[model samples]
Target chain A: MGAMSTESDPLSVHDQVVRSTYACIARFGMAKTTVEDVVRESGLSRATIYRHFPGGRDELLREAVAWQIGEFFIRLADHVEGSADLVELLDRGIEFARQAVREHALLQRMLVTEPDRLLGLLSTESTKTLPFIAAYLLPHLERARAAGDLRPGVDPVDASDHLSRLVLSYIGARGVVDLDDPAQRRDLVTRELLAGILRP
Target chain B: MTPEASPDVRARLLDATFVCLARVGIAKTSVDDIAREAGISRATLYRHFGGKAELLEALGQRELTRLDAVFAAAVQDCATVGAACSVLVVEGAEFLLDHPVLGTILAIEPTAITPLLSLGHADAFLTAAAALVAPHLAAHVDDDAARLRGAELLVRITLSHLQSPNPQRSITDPQVAQAIVDQYIVPGFVGKSAIERIQA
Candidate 1:
C-alpha cells in the first residue's frame, strides 16, 4: 500500500494517517494507541507518517478525533436535510443524533471504560461545536419565522443557539421524552421542545 | 466509632469532603484528609460512610436536595412561567458557577469533573435535577407530561451553559439570563399567544 501510495496526493496521505489513527484508537483504546500502531494500520512508514503529521502521535490523535466528529456532523446534516419546516428539522435531527451516538461502538465503549478521555475531547471541542450547529440551523429557523410558524420576537440567532444547546443536551443524556417511543418523540419535538419558539 | 452515626457528624464529614475536594481535587483527596478536615477520626468517618465513593455519592444527593430547596425558594412567588424561568436560569447559574468546590474543581481538574457533567455519568444527575425543577414548571404548563418535558429541557439547557458557558454572555448575568428565558425557555412551555400576552 505504501509503495502504491508513494506518489499519492498529499491530502489523501494525511487523511490515510488520520483514518488509521482513528481505527487504532477504536481497537486499542486511546490510552494504548501508539505511533507504531497507526503506522502498521495505515501501512505507512514512520518517516512518512511523521512527515504528514509534524506533531506526530499527539497531533494525529487530535486530528483523528476532530475529523471523526466533523464526519459525524456532516452525516447528521445529510440525514436531516430537506425537512419542510423547523419542527420537522428538529425532530429528524434529534432522532438521528440520538440513534447515531447510541449505535457508535467507540463512543459506547468510551462512555463506560474511558469517560474522562471522551468527555475531555468533547468539552474542548464544544466551543466550536455549538456555534457550528447554531450556524447550520439558523437558516432553517429563519425560514420557520418567514412562514409565520415562529413565535413573535423569536430572533433566529438566539433561537438557533437555544435549539442547538437543547439538542446537544438531549443527545448527551436521556430526559423526560423517550426518543425511542414515536409518540413521545413527536410530542417532544412539537408540544414541548418547540413550544416556546413556535406559534400556537 | 459509634455504630449509629449522628446526622450532624455525617453532614460535617460531607462538608469536609467538599473542602478537601476543592483543595486537592477528586483524584487526590484521601480519607485521612477528609477525616482531618472534619476534625474526626478515620474510624468515625468510616462509620458515617463506607468509603470515599459512598461519601461522594451521598454528597451528590445532598447537593441535589439543597438545590431543590433553593430552586423552590427562588421561583415560589413567580406569577408566570416567564418569571419563573428567568429566576431559575439566573439563580441556577449563580448557584453552580459560584459554588466554591465546583468552581475550584473546574479550574484545577476539569477533566476529572467533565465526565460527571457529560454523557453516561450525567444521566442520573440530569434526571434528579429535572424532577426537582419540574413541579415549579408544572404550575405554568398545561399538564404533567408537558411540565416534565419543559423542566427537562430547561434543566438541560442550563447544564449545557454551565458545562460550556458562552464566551460572549454569562448566564449568571440577570439580563442575559432574562434574555435567554424570554427567547428560549418561556416560549417552549407557554404558547405564542400567551407569550404575547405576557410580553404586553
Candidate 2:
C-alpha cells in the first residue's frame, strides 16, 4: 500500500498530500501546521496540494482524520480479535489506545501544541474525529451485550457512549491523568470502567 | 439631546458600573458605588443606566461582544466547518474554564448568568455556539436524529464543562467530583448514536 500509493497509484497525489500534511502536523501541530508547510514538506506544488484537497486545510485534516481512523481500526480490531474476553480484550485495546493517545500525531499535537484547539475537536458534538470513537467501539460493545456479558437492561448503545464519554471526560481533564504514563492511567481507566460494567 | 445625556457622562457611568460589579458582583453592587467609581453624583449614575436590570443588560452586552470577538479570532485560522466548530468550543471552553472573574461567577455565583441577559442568555449562547459548531457536524445533517442527539449532547457537555468545579485537577485525586463531563456526558450522546446503528 505504501510503495504503490507513493509511486504509481492514482491517489499518489492524495497520499503525498496526507504525508506532507501529517509531517507538518507531527512537527508543528494543527494550530501552527499550514498548507504551505504540507506543500513544503511534500515537495509538491501548492497547486498540486489544492488539486488533491479542494477544501484545502480542512480537507487535508478530514483526510488525515479518515487515515487516522483507518489506522485506529487496524490496531483496535487486532486488539479486539486477539483476545476472547471483552474485559481482557478491552484492557489490551485500551493499552493500544493509550499508546495511540501518547504517540498519536493528532492527539499528541493537540495535547502539546494546541490543547484549546484539540478540546474543541474533541468536545464539539458532531465532529467526525470524536464520533469515530463511538462508531469503532459500538459494534463490539453490542456483541458483548448480545452475549449477555454486559449489565442486564443496560442499553448497549448508551453503555458504549458512556464508555467513550467516560474516557473523554477523564482524558479531557488535563493534569488529572498522565496521558503519556501508559501503564498507569490507561490500565486504571479500563479496569475501573470495566469493573462497573462487567456482568455481575 | 440634553446636558444630562452627555457621552462623557455615559462612558464614565458605564465604566463605574463594571467597577462596582467587579468588586462586589451584580447582587451586592449598588448604584451608589457605581457613582463613587465614576466620581459622579449618585443621580448621574442612574441617569446613564436606569436600574439594576438595565445596567446589567448593558454590561452583559459588553461581555458578549468581547466573547464574540474572541470566537471570531479563534476561528480566524480554521479552514473547515468541523475545525471551526470544534475549535470554537474547545478554545472557548478553555477560556471559560480559566477566566478568573467569569469562572468564579460561573462556578461560584451562577446567579449572574441565570436569567442570562434576555439577548445573550444561555439559550442564545448555545444557539450561537451551536451555529458555530453545526458546520463540523454537517455529516449528520442527513441524519437528523443523530444530529439532534449530538447537539443535545454537545449542549450538556459544554454546560457541564463550564460548571466543573476544578478544571486543573485530575480524576485520580481523592476530591474528584462525582459529575464527570466525559465519563457520563459525552458517552451518553456519542455512544447512543453508535449503539443505535448497531441495534438497528
Candidate 3:
C-alpha cells in the first residue's frame, strides 16, 4: 500500500477509488470482489473509502460500474463526433459500439461468469445511461433537422431518445441484422433505424 | 416413472418449473422441487429432462413458442402494417409486463431474469422474436429485408421499454403505443405515400 498522504482533494480521492475498484472487479469478478480488495488496490485506507462512500462495498461497486460505462460513452462520443448525416452517424456509432463490446475482454468474461452482476448494473444504471446516450445523440439529431434531412414535425429530443434506445438494444443483442457486413449495416441504418426520423 | 417421455408430461414439467421459479428464486429451485410442483416423481422428471440446464432450455423453448403464438394472434386481424405494429407493441408490452412468473422474479430477484432479456443471452431471444413476428409483417411490408428489420425493431423497442419503461410514454397505453408506432415503426417499414394513406 502507498503512503497515506495529506491529499485532501475529494474528487481525486473519488477517482482513485473508482479506478481501483474497477480494476479489482476486472481481476477478481463482481461477486467475489470485496472492500479489502479495493482498499488494497487503491492504496487507500478502509476509512477513506467508507468516508467517501457511506454505503461501503455496494456503493463502491455501483460507482465503479457507472464509471466504466461513462468511460465507454466518452470514447464512443469521440469516435462518432463528425459525420455527414444521421445515417452515417448511426452506422458508425453502431459499428463502433458493437466492435467495442466484442473486444471488451472483461465485459465478455463477466457476461459468462457473473451475468446477474452485469445485468444488475445495466438495469439500475440505465436511468443514468439512457439520458447520457440521449444527450450525446441530441446534437446530431438537431443538426440533421436544421439541414432538412429529418422528417417534418419530428422532434429532435424525441428522435434522439428513440435512436438512443435502439442503439443500446442493438449493441447488447445481435438480432437479425449482420452488423459485420458493411452492406447489411448500411441497409439496417437506412431502412430501419433512420426510417422514422429521416426524410425520404 | 414413465419409460416414454410424452409431450404432455414435458409441457407439465416446464409449467411446474415456472411455478417453482416464481415461488423460489432460480438459485433455490431444484429438480426435486420441480417434480413435486408438477405432481410427478423425480424419476419421471429425469426421464423427461437430463438435468436442470436441459430443463431450463426446454422452458425457454416453450416460452418462445407461446410468444410466437401470442404475436400471431395479435396481428391476425390487422389490414395494414401500421395497425398491426400498434397492436403488437401494446399487446406485447402488456403480455411481458403482466406475466406472473416474470413479474414475480423481477420483483424478487431481477438479476435472475434480466440476463435472459438482455446482455449475452438476448441475441437468441431477439432473433427468435423477430423470426416469429416477421412473417406477420411480411403480409404488409413489400420488401423482404424491410419486413425482417421492422420486426426486429419492434421487438427491440418493446423489450427495451419493458426493461426500462419511459415515464412520459408507457407502451401499454394504447394512445402512447399508437404514437410510437406512427412516429417510429410505421415509417421505417412503409413509404411516405403509404404513411399518408395509413394515417388518412
Best by DockQ: 3
With candidate 1 superimposed using the best TM-score fit, by how many Å does residue B35's alpha carbon deviate from the native?
1.6
Best by TM-score: 3
iRMS values for every prediction: 2.3, 13.2, 2.0
TM-score of chain A of 1: 0.85
Q: Per-residue lDDT tens digits of candidate 2, residues B60-140?
A: 676667666776776677543334445544655665555555654645455445333111133445555544444445442
In model 3, which runs have C-alpha deviations exceeding 4 angstroms? A1-7, A112-116, B1-12, B47-55, B190-200
DockQ of each: 0.56, 0.04, 0.59
The full ranking of all candidates by lDDT, starting with the best, is 3, 1, 2
Tens digits of lDDT, candidate 3, B1-200? 34336668888898899898877767788999999888889988897789888988888788868877887888889887878888888877887887777787788888776776666788887877777778877678877766777888889888887777888988898888888888888887675566677668
Q: Is candidate 1 or candidate 3 better by DockQ?
A: 3
**lDDT (CA) per prediction:** 0.80, 0.55, 0.82
Recovered fraction of real interface contacts per model: 0.75, 0.00, 0.82
1 or 2, greater by DockQ: 1
Question: Candidate 3: what lDDT?
Answer: 0.82
Report the TM-score of chain B alone for all candidates: 0.85, 0.59, 0.86
Cα lDDT of model 2 by residue, A1-200, tens digit = 13334434547778777866766776777777788888788777788788778798877865665676566657766766757665566556655665665566456546556554444333332223344556666887788887888754466665565455444433333222243565655444443355335553
Encode model 1's per-residue lDDT on B1-200: one tens digit a residue. 44336678988999999898878788889999999999989988887789999988999888878888888898889888877887887887788887877887888888877776666776887787777888877667776765676677677877888767888888888788888877667666665565667779
Compose the digit string of candidate 3's lDDT tens values, residues A1-200.
34344449888889889889988998889999999999889888899999999999889989988897888888988898778777888898889988998898998888888888787876577546887888888988888888888887799998888888888888888787798889989888876688788887
